[model samples]
Target: MSSGTAAGRSRSRSRWRAGLGRLAAGTALLTAVALLPWLSGNDPALTVLRARSADQDPSPEQLASVREQLGLDEGPFTHLVHWLGGLPQGDAGTSWVSGEAVLPQVTSAFAVSVTLMLGALVVTVAVAALVSARTLYLGSRRRLHRATGAVGVAVLAALPKFLLASLLATVCGVWLGWFPSSGWEGPASMVLPALALGVPSGAMIGGLLDQSLPAAFNEPWARTWYAYGFAPHHVARHALRRTMAGVLPQLLPTVVALVGGAVAVEKIFNIPGLGRLALDAAIAQDLPTLQTATLALILLGTVAGLLIQVLRRALLGPALRDGALPALHAPAAFRGRSTRWAAVACALALLTLVTAGLLRDPLHVDTAARLVPPSAAHPLGTDALGRDLLARLGHGALRTIGVAVAVTAVCTLTGLLLGMAPQVGAGLTEVMSTMPAVLAGLLTTAVTGPSASGAALAVCLVGWTPYAAQAAALLEQERASGHMLASLSFGAGPGHLLRHHLLPAVLPPVLRNALLRLPTTVLVLASLGFLGLGEQPPTAEWGRLLSENQPYAELAPWTVLCPAGALVLLSVLALSGTDAAAVRSRASVPVRMSRRSRRRGVQGHARPAGSYK
Candidate 1:
């Protein structure tokens, strides 16, 4: 009885500790979010005045009044305290520009976003389920089928969300006339936006399903149930349910990505959701509105993260209690050499295409064949200005890919260097990471004039965080490894350790991180272009083309659809390349042990040159 009581007390203590940890994390997140307005490098009062005054200089009296109204005269902590206190009572303060209450607009926008999110979520779940079911039906023996499906879904996943939105809008609204091109009225308008947002998410879910379903089906219990005369469908369902705890964790990243993707989707569809509103406020430097929206989104994201954690724990409580969760497994694609090669080939082909585009004059306009439809003479049709759609697409592809490559290179290099001494970059990285890439790009474009180089710099500033964080993690792990410790014990200098041991060990993961960030970099580039923060007019950039042809969308649907299609295709190619590189990098890493290598190492007196300290 005494032992049982002690055990109960221990369990209670553990639960209390966990609850406190969660509380601490939540508080930290909220504090950081609240400070975003201060971090944006603009004085709150001045920003409000500028936004309100519409580029005109505000009088000293006007500035003083604005300062008083915003409580800028109060101490920072006191101001933050008041803001936090008001949140629960449904007061989010007032907009800096419009002077209307922030909560109403935020809530109204939140409602629209929630509705859109629900539709997208439903679509993603259904797609994931269907794909999982298809895989199950194909059976584990059908390797070719599974590989093909995986590659296809991965390609689709790689496409930029904005590009997908544009394609859906142009196709459904312009050609079929089934939906409005850019509005959020009626159920029909909702369909295209939902699809645009959902497809990439669906592809992500499908990848998780692909990984989970096969493993679940092959589990001993599943096979036992199969032997007990259960129907294939029933067995599959049982397997899925049993493995759901493992599968569900993957959904968290997908959901987080969807939240970020919503910004571009809302913009493309002209939906006045919180994301679009936030983008507008940020670009215009409407501090109050921007801060309010940013806080709400951060809260939403935090709540989501918490909810996913709770849901996973609830679903797998038995596993947690029993400590039955498995160690992290290698990804399914680790052994796929052909897949990697295929990805490399696709990447090279895309580069070649871009080169051809760079060599031609994409801007050479012909008046006679204006708005011409696809034909042998003028493939992919001509735009309203009678520019060759194919050439413009090629040019856009070159610019898009170039910017993505540049940003990725900068981010990767910066991450590697910073990660080597993580302590130096930790705080700086965290601060920079909070600044949204889209917002930074917009601000840069506004300052430097619309240019791809400016957009790349903006993206580089924010996008480097992930790679840096990953590199730091890898560096720490390498430092802790037995071989690294051995080298240190043998009196290797820091430079020698980094150059000979740490660098090689960290390369694989860094390469993989770079590959993974490519699609997102492209997405940021495209989003900036979509917002008119990319290369100036007639540059033939994909997002720019989408914007330029919107007015003529009704007259020449092909003008919009063609560039949109090209964007999707280019994204597909980029993703395929990423997958391929990931596979090759994973394959290049030595397995924990290989029998033949053990003998070679034992037999040879001399260590190979490549095996330097």
Candidate 2:
């Protein structure tokens, strides 16, 4: 009875700590938002003046007047305090550019975003449920079918949201005229954007459930339920609840990601949401509007996270009490030879493309042959500048792939290190995770101007957060495992345990997670490039290529197709290769474990004979 009380108290304290951490994080982020105008180097007063009247040359008096009106003369702290003070009164200040109240604008935009998010979330749940049901139906009876479905889902998830949005708009909105491609006219308008956002996210959620549900059914409770002659449907329902108890916690990060990802989606769909508002404000250096929009997004994430937590607890209270939660598992490796061979083929194709590109001169301009189609001489054709498409692609691959590899390595190492100290890392990760790469890029661009390096820096800043979160969760799980507890009871030192137990157990999954993130990193980098925040004109980067050639897409289709195809291939390679690599890595784990055990035994025997005796 005392232990139960103690446990309850512990949980209560944990909840308090979590709440305090969130409050602190939100405050710190708002404070940063307040400082953005100052950090931007561009004078907000001048920016506002130009935004209001682009052709007018503002004098010092006008600038000073604008600054005084906007309260920019004060420090960031004052701005933050004022903003906070006004929040209770529903005041969010006035936009410098528009001279309109920020709150109403932000509120309206936020509502639209919320609606879109809810729709996307519904689609996500539906996809996850459908995928999970299909996986279970096939069960052990149709391994091939399950594997193929899983692979298809993975490929679907690997698709960049922008590409998906474009396809949906073209096919459903433009071609079929079933839905409006742009604008928020009615409920029908939301369908395409929701599907574009939800399908990929749903595929991800479905994949996660696909992994966890099988493991849940393998649990002893499931076996007991079967032994008791429970209906199959009834047992499956119970098993799903058990699986979700573990899976739901993982979705918090996904929720944060979904909000962040909406920035691009909103822009593509022409939705008048907070994402679009924020983007426009950022571009215009409209501090008041940008800050309010950013705060709204952060708040949305926090609220969603809270609701998810409440729902999980309410629905899975019995599972929680019974301590029947499963440990988060690494993605299962591909078992089929067909999947492995496909991965290999993709790698070879990519290598050949890169190799062939290296042998050509990407920069040599041939204006005479500009916009040439694929031919014997120019295999992938020439762009408007008459540069060989194949050569640019080859050279661009080096830049894109090199940056991704370097960033992934850094993120992996940083996450592992930070994850080792979860006590200090968790709150920090939470704060950083809420700031998406797009928002980070905007901030970085404000300070350093948009460049490839600034985009890379932006990605690096937020990229580590997901990895760190994963590492922290995995470390926590491992620390609570039976083997880890046994080692602790046997007097294993911290260093020994970390080296032989914790790291070995944690590294595989984290590394695999990083490997899986390669495509995302590439996509993020490309998105920034497409936004003109990455490599500038004359650069042959894939995203830049896409952005530059988009205007001429109908005229010179090859220009767009070449780069788009490259990105798709890379995505496929990363997704398929991760699975193949996991297989090899998992197979080698037992050998590595055996060797470590042998080393430990030898060390035990080699210790000074009876030193204590």
Candidate 3:
């Protein structure tokens, strides 16, 4: 009626349909959250009885009594209904561990996590601004400056949040006596935890700004201001504000990453945040606590997603224009020669650590100096059994990195093969993404009987989805590109196109995808190890170290602290490799802009359409 094209009307209808689909999906997810107690695969009566009996086996008569007393033997819906009824009163349920109200514990933990999150966010934004400002001043033609900045970002981004936390705990708290090692006592205590969590977050946000801000300052309006006798600093100030606007959409991913990274941070710092509570519940298989924690996280993620969407709409106007969403372009890679050197240096350092570890006999035990604190003679201290902590840590790194690399390799291959058929891969990826990594890992461990190989296989099972999805998305874009079409027009066959174009474009993103997935794979492996579902002792897996040394925590705190520090280090080293890869990818490829972006020129908004954080 308003002279809109048919395509525009069709797209509008499609968007509405998509909205409805999302709404239904959200409803189903909420339902699953509410019913998680029933889906935990353990009998409520048995769980309760196990807790009550401690290590003792309860009798059949006792089991029946417990079942009836708890009304678990009643209709399944009855319990869910009762739980739902209590929701209005804010009663989530009782914690199986403490036999106390779940809501209060959750509230207290949530408060702690919120405080940490707020602190991290503040650090992230402030650091991002400063980094961006610094980048603006580093004259555009200076390759050395760019390379230095890239390497710095690569190192920071490469370190896992947990590793950063452990280093802070050790160097600042234990060694330097600058802060308390682990506690939630007061404001001073929060500083180290905040830095541990915030620094890596800031690095990521800063990298985004570093990449976007320079392009923004090169726009025509900024140039016009310069031409009109505006000082370079004033033009840069305006450009920075514009750059912030363009990068606003990236906050969604940052939030998701923050939440995931918090789990390890909370554990290391001994903060009783929601992440720590979730870990406890998972290890204990405390159904009520686990389900409640899961629900809380899901709710938090949902709210964050909603808020991001609202903010995007307000800041960027309608998501779709001319009956289609705007096309997105990858950031152009920085053309610094030193980026490759930085990546090589990272690889060589990690290889050296692993090789040194392998050459040493880490398993040799000296009972004489058991539980020895760190000294010049034996660095990283000795464990309770007097095993060299440094050696075990080195061997552990070898095992952890081996598993991560193997998993990543398999995933990358699978993703590449699957990506060849985008339509098929996309649906399969969606289904796979929905499956829980923990659940899959548990199943795999059960079938294979808990070996390191089984753990790696399990992680691969769930981890491949992300790379696979990214592959499909990237390939689909490549297939639609003008060059690919032009090749087809010249009578290029599928094989020719595959050989000439598709593989080249897809390879870079796939490699970057593998790097991105590394941290998560490490986290999963460690978690499984902690649960006794990963590599057993003598293997020196970091997670197993946590479980094994827990009792020795009071007797020999170093036993626990050392392995944790090693894990953090290994994770950091692994992550830095990814950052280097990203730099290489950005530098090598010609970043193709959408037609819309080209037309808009300097004044046009160059916001990316969408991203999976």
Q: In TM-score terms, which candidate is top? A: 2
Cα lDDT, all candidates = 0.62, 0.71, 0.59
Compose the digit string of candidate 2's lDDT tens values, residues 1-613.
9989998998787667667777787777777777777888878888778888894689999998988987787877887777778889989888878878999999998888778877888888887777677656543222323244555655666666776787788779988999999999889998999898888777766765665555445445555665667667776666566556545645665667666657777877788987778877877778778888878777766776677668876766643454333243333443556666666777788899899998999889998999999999999998888999999999899898888888888878887787677545645566667677887887888778889889998888778875676666556545654445555666779997776667655676566556656766877888888787777768777777766666566678798888777766776566566556555655664466557657655332121211110
Poorly placed runs, candidate 2 (over 4 Å)? 129-134, 140-146, 211-250, 311-334, 367-371, 416-420, 475-501, 552-557, 588-613
TM-score against truth, every candidate = 0.68, 0.87, 0.69
- Candidate 3 lDDT over 1-613, as tens digits, reads 5566775786577456535544454344445443443555656566666665674677788878866766665644665566667768988777655678888777788778777777787878876666555677753322213423655654555454565677688779888999888889987778888887777667656765675555445444544565567666665665555444335534543554454336667777788888777656654445456556655655565466456545644443332222112112323434455655655665676566566556656788999989899887676678888887777767887667678788889977886786566434523443334334454455566457677787788777656654554455445445544445555665667876675566655665557546644645666677667666678777876666665665576567788776554444444444445455555654443333234224434212232222100
Displacement of residue 434 (Cα, Å) in model 1 is: 9.2
Candidate with maximal lDDT: 2
Query: For candidate 3, what is the lDDT?
Result: 0.59
Better by lDDT, candidate 3 or 2? 2
Instruction: Flag regions of model 1 displaced more than 4 Å.
Output: 1-82, 88-90, 140-146, 158-189, 211-250, 256-260, 267-270, 314-352, 363-399, 406-437, 440-517, 532-543, 550-554, 557-613
Q: TM-score for model 1?
A: 0.68
What lDDT does candidate 3 reach at residue 156? 57
- Taking the tens digit of each residue's C-alpha lDDT, what string does model 1 give over 355-407? 65566568888899899998877766888888887788777776666777788
lDDT for model 2? 0.71
